[model samples]
Target: MKRSSDRTIKWLILLTPTVTIGLWEYTRHAFLLPYLSMELGNFLAPFIVLAVTLTLVLGLFRRLEQSQRALRRQQAATASLEERESLARELHDGIAQSLFLLAVKLDQLDRTAQDEAVKELSGQLRETVREVHDDVRQAIANLQQPPSPASDAWVVPLRELLGDTAGVLEAKAEFRWTIPESRLTGKEKVELHACLREALINVRKHARASRVYVVGESEEGGGFRCSVEDDGVGFDGDPMKAKERFGLKMIRDRAAKIGWTFSAERRGELTVVELRKAGADA
Candidate 1:
């Protein structure tokens, strides 16, 4: 039914201009031709009116087309972002928290171990549990982070998100953010926050190192770059193949939604995730 309606609308759109042009041509040749009078400007009157009206109508149509295109783009971006947020929440609230509890139990078991063999096993188990705990904690933090507000009212506080993420991993996660003193628009802030969160989450889950660095810097060209880097068990193969994981898909979707460029790669033992805002050449 919807398709049929759309088809009808399309046919009407296609026919309206044709019909109008045919009527104008007919009127010019049949009605106005016999009454042509150059001295009184009567001969040019119908032509002049038709030209003006056509110009106005065409201009209006162009504006409407542009508006519709903009609306569609915005809607698509919004839907993609929402989907990413939902996936992030599910990972954080369900998988990550559960793993964190398991890690706590493993810590308790480690402290209660007395025998040498049991102690050695418990120590290994504790390390594994800690790793899992850190991963989950990072996921939760990323998932729970609030989207940036829509007004130019305030910027999403990057310091808070960074601090919380660092605490979760118990690692030396340092942040260096440099934005203009002026506040960011709500949409810009939200996109930046989402990109940063995904990058940090990737670092926590994939990088096994004790140190991570996150930086956000606005470029001179009115765009920004956010990067996350860590020395960990980086993948040996293609970055695209590595990112085939579910979490990476969410990150990609979020970046695409915001019209940002996302790239991930391993340098030596370090994994780096970078997101660049679209501006100019972006």
Candidate 2:
């Protein structure tokens, strides 16, 4: 809307002088020549044309300026809303879920007094800590993904990406996306694509896995997350080899720049690389 209005105003400004002079000449020859001498009419033409053109140009330019200001305000408001949504997704998907799981584990501890039960509770506690740690790492890796508008229709582009990157690995590749295209901004989409591409590249070069799966989902009225899962040698079972690789470090760095969470993990039997986006950004 703003662009269209500015263009219209510009055209009107250019045409103003031409139209005003034409009208003045028509009046002089067809009606006013009888009252005004030819010399006087000719002399007044430039000044009259200048006055009319100036008035119209000033008015049209003012309207253009006003429209531009309104468009800027609208864009600012949209960006702020996105920031808040991103923050909300972080809290809801990461910290909140972790805390709730901890609470459940504590409740189980309270009900059992046996030493064996106590030991089991200790294991559960340890597992929960590991889960949180894994979540953090994955969050860092996911944020680096480039995003499109939050729309489900973005599946084709992602599918093409998977085919171009993961397909050549001679593995059976599967892809799914449920997140709406309206959920992410254009910049987010770009960053996310970069991260996913890197993750897939890493899988092809190192994972030595047979199956690769990519999935994206938006929570019910909440945040969105996408993960790349593979049957490669899982990272959790092998501690010495689990240190962050350079590719993952690059991914984490990219994620940090945009405030999203991206992570790659190898569990007991599966390797997963995920990117998570909150509902908005702060």
Candidate 3:
């Protein structure tokens, strides 16, 4: 009911000026024009008023459009954030808990297995389970929150995450970071670090490469570019097909969410992942 009333009011408001102007013009022509000439002032006055009134209406329309756009953007951002939170909760409550239970089962098997080989297999299973658990926990933790605001010293934390990943993979990883030693906003650092981690994880899982190299440098524009390269048995399938893998999907989503360009391709025997931050050329 209120909305109907508001709509009616808007229509009335819009038509009132037009009706008044028409009525005044008709009245002036029929009554006043016999005694008074339609001089320049008399001719221009109604048009000037109409112009001012139309200008105000147009301005109001523009403001309404802007407000609607802003509201849509805010709603989209809120929905995205809620989805991430739900994903994190599911991972923690479902996959993570399942892995823990599997670890416990392996522990029990270790005690009951009679053959030495069976015992060794159980130990390996336990270790694998633990590694999986850790990886899932890290992924959940990373996705649970938004990126911190941009800061001057972003690369430091990224370097740490990379170093940790290298240790976890037990692979030889080298960093060629060139970001300036300035404080980066929290948001910038988190995104940069996430990109680097995704690249390294891909290398560790699929590349089967012994050595990995991470290079970070200032892009020609304002932002930066980071590349991870590994000399491994490169995949032969289409890159899009490979994205069916959850890890690759997550990497792509994270890059896109942060307004970064992400590409992965196999160059001969080397699998390379590149990330580019956009709109930095201020």
Give all candidates' CA lDDT scores: 0.66, 0.73, 0.72
Instruction: Name the candidate that leads on lDDT.
Output: 2
**1-282 per-residue lDDT for model 1 (tens digits):** 444554555565566566666775677677776665444444455665567557755655655565565567567657756775888878877877777677677677778877778878877877887787787666656545543322112334555655666677777777666754332456766776776677677666666667787776777545777787777777667655654565656767888886788888776766778888755544
Model 3 spans with C-alpha error above 4 angstroms: 1-46, 147-282
**Which structure is stronger by lDDT: 1 or 3?**
3
Pairs of residues clashing in candidate 1: none
| Number of the candidate with higher lDDT, 1 or 2 | 2
The TM-score that candidate 2 achieves is: 0.41
Residue-wise C-alpha lDDT for candidate 2, range 1-282, written one tens digit per residue: 678878888899888889888999999999998899999999999999889867778878877887786777667656856765686578668776776677677667756656877867777876776677577655544443433433234467667767765667777888877765555679877887778777777777778778888788886534788787889865644432456666666777888898768776765678888877665332
How much lDDT does candidate 1 score?
0.66
lDDT order of candidates, top first: 2, 3, 1
Q: Which stretches of candidate 2 lie over 4 Å from their true place?
A: 1-155, 220-222, 236-244, 280-282
